[model samples]
Target: MTDLERDHSEPPDCLSIVSQVTNSTRAGKRERLAGAAVRVLHEQGVEKTTLADIARAADVPVGNVYYYFKTKDQLIEAAIEAHGHHLQTMLDELGRLAEPQDRLKALLRGWIGERDLTAQYGCPTGTLASELDKRDDGLDRAIAKVMGRLLAWVEEQFAAMGRTDAKELAVALFASYQGVALLTNTFRDPDLMATEGARLERWIDSLT
Candidate 1:
């Protein structure tokens, strides 16, 4: 599939793993597993994380996982898909703001949850792609779509601001985010995330 097609496409659900989340007839164990997988994948690199770890985190029997996911790869793929769902929710919420500047600020504001958690784990949406890229195994593309769409959304905000280099601005803005996240995670300094978030908000205000 083309890059555009890939971006627009719904990632494989790994046998409807997500749909099962809302099926009241079931115990919602699948939802818990998917949520736990996201948490495990974020807190630990994909290469080091095991299905057993995820099972333990979800409090599901290790053997039960195979009923939902035949392999760890399927679980990971589904977890990455779950991230897309989460990112869309953020975008939808940010869309509620009226002005482009407010929408952009809202985007940054959305990142301010559980500071020490972010300091310890880094930005979940951004860091997962970075972690997978380390493997060079080509699985990073799934997560990269989420990042691409995020940058595209930010670029739209800058373009609305009449910035000719809107795309470049988007790149720089996102780079600042990742850089701050790296520093926060490295130093375990929760303040770094807040400080950088404030700086970005002010910088947005400074734009002509």
Candidate 2:
């Protein structure tokens, strides 16, 4: 029988109890698994991390992981989505500031300040996107959508500065940020990001 049919075959009262217990257990297990996956990805990166590693780190059976997440990519995608949402919220808060330049400055500062974490794990979404590019098209598209939103916001900031080619300028700024972030990750020093970020900000100020 199909999984859904099997699920529905249970007695109504038994099914209700099973559903509650299953949901509660699944919630706790998902949290642990997701947390373990994040730690593994942060430490070993998405390319090197394995299902066995995640299962061991989470103290769950390898089979149990499949019960929660259908595949490793699903787990990674969920983690990426969570991290992206966090960054989106932070960017939205920065976007709410009175002045566009101030908002841009805040973004720069925040980006540079992330060196503490980025120095170790790199940019979560960026790293995940790089790995996803090698694997699933759907995951890659989802990550691209998130990045597109950020790029659009940056373009809006550039437009506010009266830059005619806001889209191109925004792409340039993002490329610079990504390059510096990758460098910082490789070198294990936040200073590279700080130095380049300062230069970029100065250049932006000159444009205004």
Candidate 3:
């Protein structure tokens, strides 16, 4: 029998297939909405971005957004969690480098690679953290925790390099990065980020 005829004879689990497809579509919509929220929030700041803005960015209907995220705050929280997960994944990948100094340089390189975007929107995590800090709510604390994780990871790298002042070094590194990010955004100069990133890389080498 032909494949179509065999399928007709067998009568596949149509309900199961339909259920799986529906669930998959729901998951896709949610992920798209969350991703769009992150981009919009990063570019527009959380206070200025509305649910409709996110829906437009996601290509999901505004009504459908409520089906996934009940409120704007919910979407913001989801975006924060998404950023946290992404940060953890990046740190985990950087952790694979054999030399701690190489891992630090790799991070600077990764940031430099995104220089254009950073020039346009500022550092994604840093900008979000600064905006959320004004909220003085649970989200402020949530984003703070995300930044703290990054600081802790950098400190670990410095500690691994046999530096007794690992925490201080981590703070200084992040401060420099955040400062450069602000200036890059202010001037719309991606090259500035590249230059500063190289300087930071050299500084990292000097420490090692």
Stretches of model 1 off by over 4 angstroms after superposition: 1-26
TM-score of each: 0.84, 0.78, 0.87
Q: Which stretches of candidate 2 lie over 4 Å from their true place?
A: 1-28, 55-62
Name the 10 consecutive residues with the lowest summed lDDT in model 1: 4-13
Q: Would you list the C-alpha lDDT of every candidate in the order shown?
A: 0.81, 0.79, 0.86
lDDT of 3 by residue, 1-208 (tens): 1353354322222334453465645446666777888899999999888889999999988887776666778778888888898989999999999999999999999999999999999999999988888885688888889999999999999999999999999999999999999999999999999999999999999987
Pairs with steric clashes in candidate 3: none
> What C-alpha lDDT does candidate 3 achieve relative to the native structure?
0.86
Comparing 2 and 3 on TM-score, the stronger one: 3
- Between candidates 1 and 2, name the one with more favorable lDDT: 1
Q: Residue by residue across 38-111, what tens digits does model 2's lDDT show? A: 77887787878898899899888988778777778888776666666777899889978988888888899988
Best-fitting candidate, measured by lDDT?
Answer: 3
Residue 23 miss distance in model 2 (angstroms): 8.6
Worst 10 residues of 3 by lDDT: 7-16
In candidate 2, what residue range of length 10 has the lowest lDDT sum?
7-16
Q: What is the per-residue lDDT of model 1 for residues 1-208, given as tens digits with 9 covering 90 to 100?
A: 2342353223333336454565454456666788899999899978889889999999989998887777787788788888888888888888888798898888888675556878888888777888778765556888898888889999998998889999998998889888888889889998998988999999999996
**Which sequence of candidate numbers ranks them by TM-score, best first?**
3, 1, 2
